[model samples]
Target: MRHATYNVNGIRARLPRLLEWLEREKPDIVCLQELKCADESLPIADIEAAGYGAVWHGQKGFNGVAILARGDAPKLRRVGLPGDPDDSHSRYIEAEVGDYVVASLYLPNGNPVGTEKFDYKLKWMERLGSHARVLLAEERPTVLAGDWNVVPEDRDVFSAKATRHDALLQPETRAAYRTIVHQGWTDALRALHPGEDKLYTFWDYTAGCWQRDAGFRIDHLLCSPEAADRLRGAGVDKWARDQEKASDHAPAWVELV
Candidate 1:
C-alpha cells in the first residue's frame, strides 16, 4: 500500500488541485495538513465523491488536519495531541487505517527567532516526543506523517546560511525532532535516498523558490519499526509543486510491502 502526506495550505482553495492529485497518484491513504477551514466548512462531499472517506479536525482560517482513506473511512482514534489539554490548535489527528496507526500533524511554524511562537514550537515538539514514546510502546505499525516544519539538517535545505534565523532550521527544533526519531522511528525519505543531498518537499511561493529549486525537506513520514520493515519506496511529488496555483508543499509519500 501507498501512504502520502500533503500540507494543502488551504483546503477550500486547493480542493481542485488536491482532487486532481488524488486521482493521479491513487495512494491508499493520505494525511493532510493546513486545511484552514472550519469543520463545517470542509468540502466533505467532494472528497467522498472522489472515493475517499475522511476524518478531519479543522480550525477556522488556520491550522487543521485530516486523514483520507481510499474506499473507506479511517477509524477515528484521536482529534488532538495528548499532553496539552488547553492547546487549541487543530494541528494533529490520528486514526487507524487497516493495520496502521497513522497521525497527521501540522507542527507550529515558529518564525522570527525570539518570540512566543518559537517557544511554543519547542514545547509542542516536547509534547509530541512524549506522546510518540507511548505510541512506540504499543509496538504496532505506525506512521507519523505531516508538515513537521523543521528542516532537520543543513543538507535538508537549499541554503543553510539563508535559513539560519528561521525557526525551522533552529538547532533546538532539529534536536527535538531527532529526539522523537531516536525512539526507533525510521525517517522514510532519508532511509530510501540517504545519499541524495538535495531532496526537498517544500518551496516558498515567493522569491521564485520553486523556479530556482530553493526548497526544504520539512514534510516527513516517520514510521515505527513494524512499519519500517515494510518500507518499499519513498519520494516527493515535485511536479505537484510546479502546478498552477499550487500549494507551497508538494506531496511526500511512501510505499510499503
Candidate 2:
C-alpha cells in the first residue's frame, strides 16, 4: 500500500493541481490538511470523479483535514483530537483503511512568540501526546501523517539561522515532536534518507524560496511499529511544488509491503 500526506493550503484554490497530482501519483491512501474551506464547500464531485472516496472535517477559511482512499471510503475513526472540549479547530481526522489507522493533522502555526497562540500550540501538542500514547498502546498499524508545523532539527531546514527564532524551530516545539517520535514512531522520510540533506517538503512563496531551494521539512509520515515493519519506500514529491500556482507544500509519501 502507498500512503501520502499533503498540505493543500486551500483545497478550492488548488483543486486542479490536486486532481492532477492524484492522477499522477495514484497513492492508495492520502491524508490532506489545510483545506481552508467549510464542509459544504468541499469539492466532493471532483474528488469522487477521480476515483477516490473521502471523509473530511472542514472549517471555514482556515484549518481542516481529510482522508481519501482509492476505490472505497475510509472507515471513520475520529473527527477531532481528544482531551480538549473547547478546542474547535478542524485540524484532525482519522480513519481506517485495510487495517491501517491513518490520520491527517494540521498543527497550529504559533508565530510571534510570547503570545496566547504559542501557548495554545504547546498545549495542543501535550494533548496530542496524551492521545498518541493511547494509540501506541493499541499497537495497531498506524500512520500519523500531515503538516506538523515543526522543523524537527536544524538539518531539516535550509538554514538554522534563518528559522532560529521561528516557532516551528523553537526548542519547545522540537521537544514535543521528539517526545512523540520517542514513543516508537518511525519518521518515514528520514528513515529512508538518513544522511541526505536539503530534502524538503515545504517552501515559502515569497522571496523565491522554492527557486532558491530554501525549504523546510514539515510535512511528515510517522508510522507505528506495525506499519514500520512493512515500510518499503518513502519520498517527497518535489515536482508538485514546481508547478504553476502551486502550494508551498509538496506531497510526502511512504510505501508499504
Candidate 3:
C-alpha cells in the first residue's frame, strides 16, 4: 500500500494542481491538511470525480484536515483531538482506510513566539501526545500524517539560525513533539533516509527561499510499530512543490507492504 500526506494550503485555490497530483501518484491512501474551507464549501464533487472518497473537517478560511481513500470511503474515526473541548480549529481528522488507521493533522504554526498562540501550540502537542499514546496501545497499524509544523532537529532544517526565533524550533515545542515520538512511533522518512540532511518537505514562498533551496522538514508521517513493519520506502515528492500555484509543502509519502 502507498500512503501520502499533503497540506494543500487551500483546497479551492489548489484544485488543479491537486487533481493533477492525484492523477499522477494514485496513492492508496492520502491525508490532506490546510483545506482552509468550511465543510459546506469543500469541493467534494471535484475530489470524487478524481476517483477518491474523502472525509474532511473544515473551517472557513482557515485550518482543516481530511482523509482520502482511493476507492473506498474512509470510515470516520474522530474529528478533533479529545483533550480540548473549546478548541475549534478543524485541524485534525482520523479515519480507517482498508486495514490501517490514519490521521491527518495541521499543527498550529505559532509564529511570533512569546504569545498566547505559542502557548496553544505547546498545549496542542501535549494533547496530541496523550492521544497518540492511546493509539499506540491499540496496537493497530496506523500512520499519523500531517504538517507537524515542528522542526525535529537542526539537521532537518536548512539553517537553524535562520528560523531560530520561530515557534517550530522552540525548546518546549520540540520536547512536546519528542514526547509523542518516544512513545514508539517511527518517523518514516527519517527511518528510511537516516543520514540525509537536506531532505526537506516545505519551503517558504517568500525571501527567495525555494529559489535558494532553503527549506525544512516539517511535514511528517509517524508510523506505529505495526505499520512500520510494512514500510518499504519513503520520500518527499519534491517535484510537486516546484510546480506553479503550489503549496509551500510537498507530499511526503511511504510505501508499505
Candidate 4:
C-alpha cells in the first residue's frame, strides 16, 4: 500500500492540482494538512468524484487536516490532540484504514523566537509526544504522517545558516520531534536514502526557493515497527510541486508491502 502526506496549503484553491495528483499517483491513503476551509465548505463531492472518501477536521481560514482512503471513507479515530482542551485548532486528525491506523497533522510554525506562539508550539509538541506514546503502545501497524514543521538536523535543510532564525530549525522544536522518533517510529524517507543531502518536501514561494532548490524536509511519515518492517520504498513527489501555482509543499510518500 502507498501512503502519502501533503500540506495542500488551501484545499479549495488546490482542488485541481489535488485531483490531478490523485489520478496520477493513486496512493492508497493520503493525509492532508492546511486545508484552510470550514467543515461545511469541504469539497466532498469533488473528492468523492476523484475516487477518494475523506474525513476532515477543518478550520475556516487557517489550520486543518484530513485523511483520504482510496475507496470508502476512512474510519474516524480521533480529532485534535487529547492533552489540551483549549487547543481548538483543527491541526490533527486520525483514522483507521485497512490494517493500519493513520494520522494527519499540521504542526505549529512557531516563528519569532520569544513569543507566545513559540511557547504554544512547544506545548503542543509535548502533547503530541504523550499521545504518540499511547499509539506506540498499541503495537499495531501505524503511520503518523504530516508536515511536522521541524528540521531534524542541519543535513536535512539546504542551508541551516539561511534558516537559522526560523522556528523549524530551533533546538526545542528539533528535540520535541526527536523525542517522538526515539519512541521507535521510523523516519521513512531518511531510512531509505541515508546520507543524501538536500532531500526536501517543501519550498517557499518567495526568494525563488523552488528555483534555487533551497528547501527542507519537514513533511514526514513516521512508521511504527510493524509498518517499518514492511517498508518497500519512500520519496517526495516533486512532479506535484512543479505545476503552475503549485503549493509550497510536495507530497512525501511511503510504500509498504
Candidate 2 residue runs with Cα over 4 Å from true position: none
- For candidate 1, give the lDDT of residue 245: 90
- Top candidate, metric lDDT: 1
TM-score of each: 0.99, 0.99, 0.99, 0.99
Q: Candidate 1, after superposition: displacement of residue 239 in Å? A: 1.1
Candidate 1 residue lDDT tens string, 174-234 = 9999999999999999999999988899999999899999999999999999999999999
- The 10 consecutive residues of candidate 2 with the worst lDDT sum are 127-136
Write candidate 4's Cα lDDT for 98-186 as tens digits: 88999999999998878998998999999999999999999999999999999999998999997899999999999999999999999
Clashing pairs in 2: none
Better of 1 and 4 by lDDT: 1
lDDT of 4: 0.95
State each model's CA lDDT, in order: 0.96, 0.94, 0.94, 0.95
Clash number for candidate 3: 0
How much is 229 displaced in model 3, in angstroms?
A: 0.4
- Model 4 spans > 4 angstroms off: none
